[model samples]
Target chain A: MITSAAPALSRVHDVTEEVFAAIREVRDATVAALAPERPLVADLAALRPLLWSRLTTGPLAALIAGIGFIAAPGLLADAPWYLEWWQQHPSGQPRQLLRDLDPASSAFYDYTHWEWFTGPRVGRERTICGPYVDYLCTDEYSLTLSVPVTVGGAFAGAAAADVFVRNFEAAVAPALRELPKPAFLINAEGRVVASNSARWLSGSVYRGGLAVTPVPGLDLSLVQGPAAE
Target chain B: MVSSGARLAVFSPVDSTARVEAVVRRLADAIVLGLLTDGEQLPSEAELAARLGVSTVTLREALMALRQRGLVETRRGRGGGSFVRVPPDSGLEGRLRGLTVAELRDVSDHYAAIAGAAARLAAGRSLPSDLAPLRRSLDEMAGCPSPRLDGRFHIEVAAASQSARLTQEEIRLQADIGPLLWLSRDTPEGQDEMAKQHQAIVEAIERGDGDQARLVAERHVLDATDHLIELRLRLQD
Candidate 1:
């Protein structure tokens, strides 16, 4: 949204940049760690320390929930996972109970369909995929900001991180709210991601007037308005 | 004063149990965890019945079960009531030694989720006053990282998070595994290292750093689980 409040808008941009940078860092580190000679089938345990350390050690650590790889199929037989790492303690406490996930039971909705997985698979670009319900991971509304990890120009897998959606919205919504005119953060498909005014709801179509601008470092474009009659 | 967590966990309404069996397990857990101490007489039959939300008959049945297990000593006449007999260390150790690596990993993974969430919520929800208990726990643990106090250190963080349900769940988990977890930390190096990890989580909470607190808390638990798994493996060798 076009807010005169540059600082708040910049705040949104800063966090977006910071999160994407972490995803890029994971991709780069993963590529360097997995030698070309090694099997494309990744070792989750060996790769986890780097993900855990990179995600937890630095300034933006709090914003992330978990990070790891989601592989392309047939890479490892009997092991559907190329590598998967959920942050050690998810909500800020030690988990004393763990629900048994049947490794053999393919219960999850397909991961290949997810933009976080496929967008990078196709374009090989770092993609931010969410603010939606992550049925596969936290089972909460979250974001999966990811980048394609490659070995010798072959798509090995995608390195990704999970950020809860509430935190994502919090980081950007306040800035969007400071706008004077009717304004919205619309995704590529013209659906509202967030808005400064109540005339448009999040995920609803922004059926209003002109003045579209892109918020820096984010994929969503801002729409400023007067409803076109 | 009882910790906020203790208040929630200690006084639960246990109306939905299978009567005697649940009381027996509950009381046994309390005794082993030292929430009910040796030589400390339990409340009168009637008082205990009400407090436990069980009938006197059910409570008596549980007492009989505890006595049979050598966990309770019931004396008669004046100043007489059910009393706790400290759990046998041999039994505890034998049980510890019997555990497999897979079982210990399950415990660790579960602890990480509970403790990590508590630390995260504590950072956002805790007041300066809430921070006091965590500091108190750190000091108690620094001096002597006993099973009781070490477990309490983690529980206190959950309490500071101000989620009663989380605190209660934490208490149950801590009571179940907290004492046994000490088996691996009996060495001086393990104790000292645990203290450092505990300190990091505590300081992160004090500074209102939710991410740091969660990160440290999660790592601390995962580390403990790994140590236990390693020890179990070495014992097999």
Candidate 2:
């Protein structure tokens, strides 16, 4: 609601560029990974660990919670062909495992209706689904970044990566700890993903207020409260 | 810490035919905030009537009012009673967007107080395990496909405070104000800003910093209030 904050600040722009580039790496790697699979659109059940490993071997690892492809209808038996979620079962030794999604469950709550699915379908570009709970599937709050996975120029589905909300906040909190005033970041849906102040902190939504500045090149914005002066 | 049967403590039974609005408002708030889930059946008419301390006549009238607002629906025949039709403000944003800025500000102010106090108390009273849900809830908020879950974040924080009153008030506020805020639509930029703020609060509470928690909590609400005031000015302009 507060559009008062236009695109401003080079630092926000810098961070935005860095973040998007990392995402692009994820998308390109996914597309490339799919390209050599022979029947590229066939049940990609074997590629889960590869995709997870490829995406997490970078500076963005902590930010990632899961990665997978939600194949098109009749493509993967109505479920993601290969979904990889990070699991730390026996004390923080994180491991990647395939996410088992049942067809009956997937059918009940159509994926095509979800933001991560629809946003890419409509935009024909990579998109963000939510600061939302994938209530049935992931059950964790995440901002899923998804890009279309096409073979022979035909849309197969989406190659997506998730950033756990907790990871995002924990990573950024230290950097903002020194700021004298309240500042925060919000996703396109207006969900607050991170903040320096408690006012518009992570996990809350930012309605609107002063010092609103859009984080350039991303579907996000940065804002601070009014200046004391 | 989650006691399902605890809510009845907050509901005062209605005795007279005169307190219709009050009765309606209290019940309506419960529905909007998700103290009641979608399609969840209410207590039997007679049971509910007794519980609310109202005669069957007044209870019926309240149900009628709720039905008019699309918050509940009654079906005749077996296997049907008063089922929650709207299910915790399913249509919250749409309805809220139609409100004047003044009304929106008033609602936010009320929510802010409940939520801020809840955060402070949660910080004050809860153990580390109790505050753990903050992370989980924040994660849910990140990918929260709906506003109901987002609002539940505050309610959960209140619940962690271990104060029944704060928790109950939070449930009402989350239903009445939290989801409604999403109706107006915040920019992704604003959402990002808010997310960071949430993390700060969570960190403080985890550290058991009550004063800091209260300060942050109060600031969050005041800033939201300020936003509404600004929007109102723009409308007048």
Candidate 3:
């Protein structure tokens, strides 16, 4: 019986090698198809969809799915309140609104009278208030409150507002600070009005390249202020 | 005679298959260690079976076992037969995932030490060319608009050190720490602090200040470890 079965087993072994070879070819081709320029992380991302399919359709799929559910509890356990707030106010252009608000001074700005006005646009929440002492009120977006009021809330409302603003400022300040300040401005003439060190170092033409030349006889000084004249 | 043949067939013992499996394993090890060259044709089944003092069937079984190990391939047509094939190290991800937190911590320690050393070395060397890529990585990182890219920038920095072993180890470390980093990426405070730390490391590397680089890199990893611990505690609560 052993003799007879030995021959059959050998044949099975041969077949197994063939299948393995085919699998190897497939793997090589798949790896090669992922071009060298594609990063390892990108490769992982691409593999994830394939893996997901395998996990869903293969024998171990159920076990993996169960593990996924188990692992998800840690992720789903705590939803950050700030994230929720951000989502609710998606259009919350906090950076644009707080661009001029002094970080050190803004911490003390009063939020007691400040009301969080939900924007009509998705994901936007704006704080609204009437003008107060040391406050600059231009437009709704330009209403800069003093630092004292921000930290000077009477009760929990002030504390909550302070926390909310702090979170908002922290979220946006880094981005605004990193943005390259505009270097050169072309007035009416083709001459460069102003150039930042970055612009000078990089050598960028601000006014006229070949298309629309700078307007003739325009004042370059007018572009100096925060607002263009 | 017919009754006896039926009984023998029904109760046939295939225990010799274990011997075939053993041969397959040896061959696989040889292939993996580069003892066998890729595309090298293996001995014929008859030859192997004769060599092993087994029937051709058992030899075939051994070959099949090798195939399962990704060490060999077979062709069915004439002049087509078994050949050696090199398998990719696909087990890397699984191996990385299997690492315990303690193992990961060890890796983190090694990473910190090596990175600190590299920064110090680069600083002492003071070769502008050596520092160029580090600066470039930092610039790219600073320009990145998303937190995901920000995390990737650090990983890229580790990889750009030009040490394959270090890169591989760092990749494993990244996998171990990835989920936690992903969780923290959305937090404003977390993101800001992380970006600042990353910038500090880059600046130090650029300035050829090894001590600063070492301090920054070590602090970054330690801070991340602390954050993860804090997060775990929060979750426990």
Q: Highest TM-score, which number? A: 1
Off by over 4 Å in 3: A1-229, B1-108, B125-133, B143-148, B159-162
Of 2 and 3, the candidate ahead on TM-score is 2
Model 3 misses residue A85 by how many Å? 49
Taking the tens digit of each residue's C-alpha lDDT, what string does model 3 give over A1-229? 1112223223323322332333233233334333444223223223222323322343322211110000001111221010000000122111101111221212212222222211111212122111111111111111111111011121101100112222222332333223234323332222222233243211112333222322122122111212111
TM-score of each candidate structure, all chains considered together: 0.44, 0.43, 0.28
| Candidate 2: residue A22 lDDT (0-100) | 56
Q: Name the TM-score of candidate 3.
A: 0.28
Over the stretch B11-85, how does candidate 2's per-residue lDDT look in tens digits?
Answer: 434235555665686577566655577788998988776445456787888999999988888988999899887
List each candidate's DockQ score.
0.01, 0.01, 0.01
Worst 10 residues of 1 chain B by lDDT: B1-10
